[model samples]
Target: MGRGVSGATVVMSRNKFIIYIGILGLLIAAGYGVWSTLEVGGELVLSGVVEADDIHVGSKIGGRVLKVAAKEGQGVKAGDILVLLEPYELNASLAESRASLKQAEAKLAELVAGYRKEEIDQAKADWLAGKVQHENAERFRRRMGDLIERELISHQDYDDAKAKAEEAEQRMKSAKERHDLLLAGTRHEEVSQARASVEMARARVEILKTQLDETVIRAPVDAVVEVLDLEPGDLVGAGKPVATLLRTNDLWVRAYLPEKRLGYVQPGLKVKIRVDSFPQKNFSGTVRRVNRQAEFTPRNVQTTEERVLQVFQTEVVIEDPDRLLRPGMNADVFIPKTSS
Candidate 1:
């Protein structure tokens, strides 16, 4: 009977130990669940890739590449020469335009100045000679008319004299008009037309000069050259990209957050960013923007559940001015939930 009692006691002790272990396991699991829920609700982490302003540098006009002043991964400042296009054709066109402009200008100046001293003197002399010829013709016609009336000359002879007199009179009138025109400088309409021509030629010259300047490609902003597609002899068409430049100052990370976490993120919120390249360094950034619409989870999403959940795109701008971060670098962003 005592053996039976000891055996029952051992069975009871084993049962109690098993019960205790079960309770401990339940408590640990419950604690882990609460901690995980709190962590998810209080903070959010998103993965993204770094991005910068990509500027495609190209020519406004087509030409062969003459020289490349920059190379891939080169940092350049605003107004720095990035490439040079063959300016041979442009220069030649410019020279021709300048010559035409000079000619137009000289013509306009001459018109404005009217007739010269020698020209005016010659005109006056021609007018006097025409007047003398007209007077002599008039006298000869009068003599012919008197002779015809007395039957000393035929009707045909008198008609010829009269015709000569009329011609001389017309010549005199033309000479007098020519002299008057020379003394009148230039007419307002003529001067205006000449000035218009000069202006047109001037505009052509200015346009060609501008095109020539465009042959020397310059960086529009301070950036790093990300691509150099042309060499010394490559033919680049008009508006063709010669290089791609990334603005170092405009760096950001393109990240997406779960739709449910939208309320916890907003523009101007402070965040921390980390990159695999610089494991020890954490960069500071501010939420620059958050997309209004929700979309399917991106292909790079880590969790299967996240793939089905709608996500909003978020742009976090890096505050680093030294350009320690580069585009396409995978980054992790951590944002703290703000108390509403």
Candidate 2:
């Protein structure tokens, strides 16, 4: 009886020992399987930050800033009023230029229209009077010639009358020439000169108008105002940066990935993104671009030597960005393998 009891106790002990060993082996295999799943054909996450398109707004002309309509962090659209400059000087210049142009145009019109009607009538009357005097002189000269031939008058007196008749004929010719010129109106050369003057005046007016229109500054694109450099009564110089704007619609993240995974990462590949600011949310995005060249990681990045040894730059663009994501915000991107 004693031997049977001992044998039974031994069998129970062996069974318990075998069961414990089997459980331990299963636990080890499960741990190894979990580790292998984490290591192969998995997603690699890279760190980056959100960025926006940047721009600088400048003034074309120098003037005192009369009003600044935009503030920092303000959203604006194309053609929205951004700034207003002191336009009094520009207005005065434009007015003066317009007046000068009007005067020039008036002068040009007068020149092109030709001589006055009264002046032409006066010339005609002078010509008629001179013709009458010439006819009277010719008749008197003829009579003097006949008297001289008949010996009724001295030769000196006949010569004097002939001279008077010739002088009267010359006066008539001069008066006729004056009448013809006055009736002909303005010459082609004079009209051409007047037209040129009008064109020059118009060009000046147009230049002044362009300058006046530049006084009101408008936004060039749909963006957010990043900076404001001037206020009311502030003097701004030509070519100086008045404000800084950033395009908010096309936001992208700059990241680096291992060169070994270059085949999997390409433009148009879908990606998963997470921002440090929004820990609970995951952003959907795509690989918009990738750099061809490989470069070392920047010294500022906190990465292991293996990761920094060689990496390729990549740009991921977010499809639907909300107010939460902004420029300079830290982000992490997950690039899944083909099998994943």
Candidate 3:
């Protein structure tokens, strides 16, 4: 009877242990199910890097660098001078152009003003001199005519006097024409030509002015200098990059989303961006754009659904990117799903 009771008690203990184990397993399974459901229905997060556009600033004209006002990673505002090129040659050219323009403008003014007082006086004096000579020649020609009629002078003498009078008359006429031209000032065609010359000179000066301004390279946008390729006394070529500036104000997170999740993503959607550099802070962003076409799957997408052969690129522009975010820094973008 004692053996029987001991065996029964042992069997009963084994049954209770099995029941407790089964109940615990069921509870554990139910908890796993709830966790998986939450994971599936939670907000989607994407991994990407902070990126921005880079601008290469340089001079339009090539010359030796005179000064580098900015260093690598220096912040600069738009229109700030980042580099200065030697302006000796360009300045000389500009001065020459300005002188030429001044001369042209003066000529135009002179043409518009007509003749000067001294020039008109000289022209009038020549005309009066020609008139006096013509009058004297006419008197001599009349005397020769009278002598020829009385046979006191030869026909050859009369002809000589006539030729002299005709020559004097022609001289007077030419002098009168010159005086009229002087009084009339410059001709229309001459004035037009002068104006054209002035315009051409003005255009040349403007071009030189632009070139001279280009000698001082300024930042095109608010950015941080990412590269400084030249120092003082270094030669730089035209259109060659002297410095590269990253546009910090236009910062965005470039992330890839699974092709299947593209249907829910739209422009102007709010998102939260996080970076390993600043674990405690979260940056707010907006969905600026989504790629219309699918591309090859990116490595960042790890979900089974995202493991498909295609993914879509998306850009989330940060609202206010301070020093917290940097280009090429790995970032995570979390986008909450909308209720169906």
Candidate 4:
């Protein structure tokens, strides 16, 4: 009797366990059905691809590539150095500019300060010497004239004496002019010209400095380097893109909506996004804009002939707080139909 009772109790316990498992399975199935409905039932889904603005980074002033700091598919922050150009030429130019600026500034300073005392003194000395030479030459020429009149000196000797006197007078005049100019000091026009030259030289130096800074290619926004085909020895031209970066911080979606849907869609409309990679997750976004004009579908539509007709381009700005989304990912946008 006791053995039978124990066997009965065991059988009863197994039955209860099976019943509990069946009830749990039914509950799970019911919950999954509800979830599927919630995921699939509501909203008009529009398909698009994740897109971000591609930033082309290059040097404003070109040179041979000196260093490539980042590579393809590498994430980078704003202001990060992506590449460096050979600064030897720019550095040399900057040095030359500095020298030129210094020379011009020195000239300006000299003009502003006027002739030094030592220079004036030397001019005075030169004038005195020239005067003495001129007086002596004049005396000799007069003597030679008297000799020639008496037929004591040859015609050639009198001519030579006259030439020497005239040369001495010209030299004396030049020296006197120099002395007077020193005493007169720098003229306002001369100082103005020197100052202008200094300003021009300084401006050139600043321009070269800015060009030197351009040799370093920096990221303007947080991005991923999508293309970097340059190495250390590669020569790149000015204003030519060396690397292509996909801006990750500011991402949006580009979708094509049928012309008929234009009435229901407008900017600032709330939308949900779903990517194939994360089907269970939904991202928030807002309609940024809708194209005014319509264009034919880019490619043959797989769904229906109607979808292949004219469509308006739409931009949706995705809100990716955790930065979980990336460019080129195919996405489904769920835009709520507003009562038109």
Candidate 5:
């Protein structure tokens, strides 16, 4: 009877101990659930960095830097000069082109207007003189021929007279042709050639002018100068970046959302933004875009098996009317949570 009572007591103790362990495990699981809800269940907020479009401003035509018109961190508007290069050669070339264009235009005008009245008169006079000389030579040649036929002149003398007559006749014909050409003025072909030359000169001048303008490097957009270390006499090549600018008109936050939470946000929806610089303040931002391609990247996870997760990149444009935000700032973006 004593042994049975002891055995029953031991069995009851073992059962009570098992019940206590079961109750402790339930309590621990409940605590963990409550903690997870407090930590990340309320909102889908994530961290992001502020970024802006960086523009590299430079000249298409390279040259020795004459002057640095703007410095780093300087705010500039469109068309503001950021640097100036030596344009001495370009200016000289432009002037020379302009003079050539003027000369070509003058020639074209002259050709279109024909020859002067004085020139025409001079040509006509020459033609008439040639005709008189030719007639005199012809009369002499006839006399020489008649003398040779009658054996009154030597063969050499007759030949000389004949040659003079032929030369005189040729001179008269050339003179008459010159006079006729002067009367006809310039041909259409000549006028067209002259006009073409003028156009070519003008085109060269325009190209030079454009290069001269490029020597003065100007801001293409309204931005703040981020990098401008150049000074006078710094030689740079064409299309080399001389200055870096950060556009202040639009700032964006680059964020990565997990593929599982992709449906939580879409474009055109507003979200809350906060930065460490102004933790108390809240900034408004709109979703700009979401990348369609998912990438495998490591996320903050405790277990090694859950280290990598698929995520999509998202761009959110921040709206700051007061212009307080800048690039490279750490911002906390609160993504709205949705069960669906």
Candidate 6:
């Protein structure tokens, strides 16, 4: 009876040892399978976040902010008004410049036309009268000189008549010169200078207009407003950042993969992306670019090793982007082999 009990206990111990060995063997096989899968394909994986193109909008001139046309998170199109600076000063400057331009134009026209016809006619008549007076003076001087020779007139009187003839001749000459100058148009140099002045004034007006236009800030591209730093009555200076915008359409994910997997990761290669924010959702994308240089693992990434040892940065362009995959949202990328 004791021998039977000893045989039963031996059988139970042998069976328990066999079961434990089987379980251990199964665990080892499974671990080996997982390691082999990782080694054969170099399944490099990385975590990244979606990011859009960041842009800063600023003013070109300094002035007090008159209006803020955008708010944070507002979608805006190209050329949309984003801000308005106080335009009173610019408008006044423009108006003054335009007035100066008009005045310059009027003066230029007057110079080109020269003296009026009536003024020229009056000058000519004066010249003719002076000529006639000089002729009479000469006759009187000749008559007086003969009288003086015959003692019929005094030498002083003859000398005085001769002086009158000379003075009349000089007056006629001065009158004729004035008439000719009136008939002739403006000098070439004078006309050129006048035209240049007009052009300069016109250019000044245009410059003022440009400055006024700049007071009304507009978006350079389609984007979403990310920041609004100034509102009505706020003062700003040239190149002062008034807002920030993000180009949603230009969004992409930046990821890194192990150097060993570089052969499979090429531009234009298809990829599958899954964002932690939307685990159930899967996104299709293509490799837009792969950095040729290797970099250290980002500080945000954690692995069994303190560093990734070696990795390359890559950009994946989403085929279809939605509002849910916003900038800074963490994502996972799976780059399947060509055969897979």
- Compose the digit string of candidate 5's lDDT tens values, residues 185-235: 998999999989999999999899889988999999989999999979999
Model 2: lDDT to the true structure: 0.81
- Total clashes in model 2, counting residue pairs 3 or more apart in sequence or in different chains: 0
Q: Clash pairs of candidate 5?
A: none
Query: What value of lDDT does candidate 5 attain over all alpha carbons?
Result: 0.85
Candidate 1: Cα lDDT at 303: 77
* Winner by TM-score: 3
- Candidates 1 and 3, the one with greater TM-score: 3
Per-model lDDT: 0.84, 0.81, 0.84, 0.85, 0.85, 0.80
lDDT of 6 by residue, 157-254 (tens): 99899999999999999999988888886677887898999999999998888888889888899889999877688888898788899988777888
Model 3 C-alpha lDDT per residue in residues 76-143, reported as the tens digit of each score:
99999999989898789889989999999999999999989999999999999999999999999999
Can you write out model 4's per-residue Cα lDDT over 204-236, one digit (the tens) per residue? 999998998998999998999999998889999
Candidate 6: global Cα-lDDT? Answer: 0.80
After TM-score superposition, the amount by which residue 183's alpha carbon in candidate 6 deviates from its true location, in angstroms, is 1.4
The global Cα lDDT (0 to 1) of model 4 is 0.85
lDDT of 1 by residue, 1-340 (tens): 9999999999999999999999878645433221111234556777788999889988888788889999899999999999998899878988898899899999889989887989888888999999999999999999999999999999999999999999999999999999998888889998899899999999998998888887899999989999996779988888888889999888999887766677888898988888889989999989999999776544566876554466677899998866788888888787887632
Give candidate 4 regions above 4 Å deviation.
Answer: 1-42, 120-184, 297-308
- Lowest lDDT 10-mer window, candidate 6? 31-40
Off by over 4 Å in 2: 1-47, 112-114, 137-178, 257-324, 332-340
Alpha-carbon error at 188 in model 4, in Å?
1.3
lDDT of 2 by residue, 1-340 (tens): 9999999999999999999999878645433221111223477676787888787876778689888999999999989888888889878888888887898788778777878999999999999999999999999999999999999999999999999999999999999999998899877888788788788888988987777777777888988999986779998888787888988877888886666667778898898888888888998888988898776544554556445345677899986556667888888787787623
